[model samples]
Target: MTKIEDVKLIEIPKVKDSRGNLAIIEKDSLPYPIKRVYYLYDVPSDAFRGGHSHIAQHEFLIPLSGSFDVIIDDATNKKTVTLNKPDKGLHIVPGIWRELENFSSGSVCLVLASDVFLESDYIRDYQDFKLSKSR
Candidate 1:
């Protein structure tokens, strides 16, 4: 499992103009490089998502529309980071559990992952995540 030092924050630059603001996340921009890109939205105020940890994947999350916070748990410690700007992204390394919450209305959470979709790579339980990371 990777350590806290492995995680980082990335910023996605937005080109602003009278027409519109455009920001892009490509494979070369991410720390570990991006293999897949996805997004989340329509989250309720009383709800949460991402109570899982990755075994061998890295992710970079950004709030492309409104705002949201990603609470990352490194097993021994936890860090809470809010992403509001479309140009800013938070990088989550492998072996860390993350929970995304407090999404503003009409917010878009974009994720850039280093690996393709693999259900076996995820550790969904907190205790199980910690134990698996220790091994």
Candidate 2:
């Protein structure tokens, strides 16, 4: 069976000026066209979120406010990415396990998804996750 991997890190453009900072991720601006969008905010202290992997969904996450660390894993590899800039976000591919951790106070995480919510599309268990990839 082949191993899956997390999405590559793509840098979003930030126009800095005296008027403040501005960032945007339009459908055409992303590596893949976005189909859905969501954000995580008001998270409790030291709370860990996202203990599942998608079977066919592509996700891009950013810390719109403050900062947080994203832990991503696959059957063969794992990585931790820190997202602090609203202009820069992490893109996660399907078939990868992900956990969001180390959130700063009052942090807001914004996510862009490739598909709408489908419970069957998620592989939540590590053991089942590995098996699913082999098929």
Estimate every model's Cα lDDT from 0 to 1.
0.84, 0.83
Q: Write the per-residue lDDT of candidate 1 for residues 63-105, one digit (tens) a residue.
A: 8789888888878878888889888888888888899999999
Cα RMSD, model 2: 1.8
Error of 2 at 10 (Å): 1.2
- Candidate 2, after superposition: displacement of residue 135 in Å? 4.0
Give the residue spans of candidate 2 off by over 4 A: 1-6
Model 1: ten consecutive residues of lowest lDDT: 24-33
Q: Write the per-residue lDDT of candidate 2 for residues 1-135, one digit (tens) a residue.
A: 323343677788877889898886666877677778888888985898899999788899988899988988787677888888788888888888899999999999998998999999998898898777667
lDDT of 2 at 10: 79
Alpha-carbon RMSD, each predicted model: 1.7, 1.8
